[model samples]
Target: MPEQGKKNTLIVIVGPTAIGKTALAVALAQHFSTEIISADSRQFFREMEIGTAKPSAEELAAAPHHFINSHSVHTLFSTGDFENEVLKLTEELFKVHSNLIMVGGSGLYIDAVCNGLDILPDTDLNIREQLNQQLAEEGIGAIQAQLQAADPEYYAKVDQSNPQRLIRGLEFFLSTGNKFSGYMTNSKKERPFHIVKIGLNTDRTILYERINHRVDLMMQAGLLDEVKGLESYRHLNALKTVGYAELFDYLDGNIQLPDAIALIKQNTRRFAKRQLTWFRRDGQIHWYEPDQLTAVITDLESSLL
Candidate 1:
């Protein structure tokens, strides 16, 4: 594999939301007799389950899984922390399994683990407090405009709905006289183990339908109650995600329940589009439909031979 004494290989399965990434990852893990390391940012919090679409109990029992729903919402975790933890865990997993599977739809988190993100300078908490005050008084549109003026390229790609993303870009711009996007140049980093990337894709219409249906199912499984339970922590950065954000509006009487549900579906679709854009930028990834598992697995085995 690549050369002599390459150690164990890492199989990374990545795709957009509702692309059946979890199922394929589990299947591949079973085939390889290995455990899974989750890269999902939202799925890290223990309280966020149904909305994050975490792996089911049966699936978790089928293959040993790590890092899913294992953190407290109160604890702040950065991509740098994730990169450190996953790298350490991957080395440990190598002791037992020759091939370890890592999977998720969170493109940035995956990038952090595989290709180290740029370390931005820390921001002043007082400045952060002032920015939060501005966000509260002026709303997201005001912050969006600020970020766009500072880093239009990042504004195009960053999650506009997430205030944390905006704060990060602005913090860097205000502190360093340079856009945060400038620091994130995405130069590849060296890793000790071999990494094999497998991408999953499907027809746009089909993927959208799956997303809509999954949102409906989340509702059926009491996603509204799940959000309601976390209402006390709604302001937490960890809880500020697509499904929970829309439902939070419904909880606050800002929107009708049905409208909030519809908005969740719409936002989820847009998120899928962004995920595709991020993943497509990596030319090293070998793409395939979900149904191409047999051929994909065959190629993976051949690569290690």
Candidate 2:
């Protein structure tokens, strides 16, 4: 018997990329007769199909989903925007179903939905302009080193290759003289629905192998063509992602095709490692092997029933 209020549950499935989160989310959605909200930032764009490792057509057809191709690459969808839209969507969905599932490897997006985002002090536009100028002139290493010296904790978890993130952190420190990591505290907002977090993982060697194999599959499935299609949009923040970025460098004649492909695999593996680092800091999530669907269901049933 569930409590009077707080009966609805948001089942959050999170883990490293290529950890079979989509498969588990679809299965759980089928069992609960519910829908899935994607937190994968890259999958929100229609242009990034193969590179994002989105659910296949069959898997998407298996469950109704939200926020998949819901935005254009040209638009900016910040974490705060995601949190607002998801909260509204969850409120509507709970009227029809008692359980809902949200799945992704993007830790900040997932956290924004579940626990609310940490409110940071306002940053100056001038600082942002300066940081962007520095990035253009001195390259990402300059910004990365600044963040590493100022906020090593966030530096360890953030995507280092993403100049946008590095610049944002540095800008915060410059404007407020506060470490970006210090602003991240447990200032959670109350949600009407209860949340149960689930995580999937395997040994490092196996997970790395899975990431490598997924990259190879993406390449075979015309990931290059997808990048080429978005060549004009390469400067957009959306196109500056893992697989896309490496291929863009290849197209720029800065790297060979084989080297780019290899770098994509290597960078993806590193991204997965950072994802794991970010998720592991949260102690509330229950862990499981990707194949442990039965166990996940049993635990959810016991918690929600």
Write the residue-wise lDDT of candidate 1 on 1-305 in tens digits: 12346577889999999898889889998998889999998888999999999999999998999889879999888888899999999878887777889999877788888888876677667777888888878977898899999899778778777788888788778777887877774587888888999999999999999999999999999999999999999878877778998998898899999999999999999989988988998897999998898999899989977
TM-score of 1: 0.95
Measured against the true structure, the TM-scores of the candidates, in listed sequence, are: 0.95, 0.96
Worst 10 residues of 1 by lDDT: 1-10
CA lDDT scores, all candidates in order: 0.87, 0.90
lDDT of 2 by residue, 22-129 (tens): 999999999988899999988999878999898999999999999998999989888899999999998898888888999998888998888888888899999898
List per-candidate RMSD values in Å: 2.1, 1.8
Q: Which stretches of candidate 1 lie over 4 Å from their true place?
A: 1-6
Q: How many collisions per candidate?
A: 0, 0
| Maximum-lDDT candidate | 2
Q: Candidate 1 vs. truth: CA RMSD?
A: 2.1
